[model samples]
Target: MGIIDNLEAMRAKGQDSALMRYSLGNEYLKQEQTDQAIEHLAEATGQDPNYSAAWKLYGKALTQASRYAEAVEALNRGIEVAEAKGDAQAVKEMRVFLKRAQSALDASG
Candidate 1:
């Protein structure tokens, strides 16, 4: 079965967790379903506010959807979470995405 099928099975079994939601979000992002990705990623982040990876993906999905302001918010919060967790890689990645989102906002306004 495909990833989504497996994920759906997991969800059907009520196996909801931050990781599960994050995986769903990532899968949706891969499919270019930014809205769906945002929904899952938001749930993931809400379930675990310290989830830097989820925040990163959430920001990226928002950016892909042209929601630069929200992307900036997510990225900023992600950077803080990453810093707190000593996840330098995540912080760096989020910074890059943060800049991209800022640029989009600048260009649009």
Candidate 2:
């Protein structure tokens, strides 16, 4: 199995490693598997709710999957996480992404 498959297997086995989930999500994203990416990234975010990067990636995957509403929600959560962590850069970046996702959702509706 490939690295992502191995990571997924580990996750299924209850590894619950946030870093591993994020890594697997990134690999899935690279392969254009937005659904799998979203799944793993969501798990990563759940494992560490304060992880702004994982939330951002999850938002991105949701957006790519054409789930704009969910993307906006995830981005908003990411922004909140970043703000709570006092990460100015992450907050700023997440705000940008959130706006973009909101726009996409608006356009779709």
Candidate 3:
């Protein structure tokens, strides 16, 4: 009856898509289930490599999980995708997230 239930039902019906996976990832992120979020988000990006939003969220979720190196990687790709897609807002936000990830990476070294 919740968003996850509905989304899972859709997936069970063979309705998989980048959007579906992105939504799942977003919901999992909201629940602070970074591992599940990462899984779905990775799938979302793989399903549609050009999905800037998914890439952004994926980067964010990675950062949240303290996977700084991977966060930096995902954020870099997300910025490139957003730039190509003319998503200036997403690009700006991703840049901020990138800086955070880079800082975390440096600190860990």
Q: Which pairs of residues collide in candidate 1?
A: none
Clashes counted in candidate 2 amount to 0
Q: What's the lDDT of the predicted structure labeled candidate 3?
A: 0.97
Each model's lDDT comes to: 0.97, 0.89, 0.97
Model 3, range 1-109, lDDT digits (tens) per residue? 9998899999999999999999999999999999999999999999999999999999999999999999999999999999999999999999999999999999998
Q: Give candidate 3's total backbone clashes.
A: 0
- The runs of at least 3 residues in candidate 3 whose Cα sits more than 4 Å from the true structure, single-residue gaps closed, are none
Error of 3 at 3 (Å): 0.7
* Ordering by lDDT: 3, 1, 2
Q: If scored against the real structure, what TM-score would every candidate get?
A: 0.97, 0.89, 0.98
Q: Which runs of model 1 end up more than 4 angstroms from their true locations?
A: none
**Which regions of candidate 2 deviate over 4 angstroms?**
12-14
lDDT per residue (tens digit) for residues 1-109 in model 2: 8998787788789787889989989999999988889888998999999899999889989988989999999999998888888989988887888888888899999
Report the C-alpha lDDT of model 1 over 1-109, residue by residue, as the tens digit: 9997899799999999999999999998999988999999999999999999999999999999999999999999999999999999999999999999999999998
TM-score between candidate 3 and the true structure? 0.98
Q: Give the TM-score ranking, best first.
A: 3, 1, 2
User: Looking at candidate 3, what is the lDDT of residue 91?
Assistant: 98
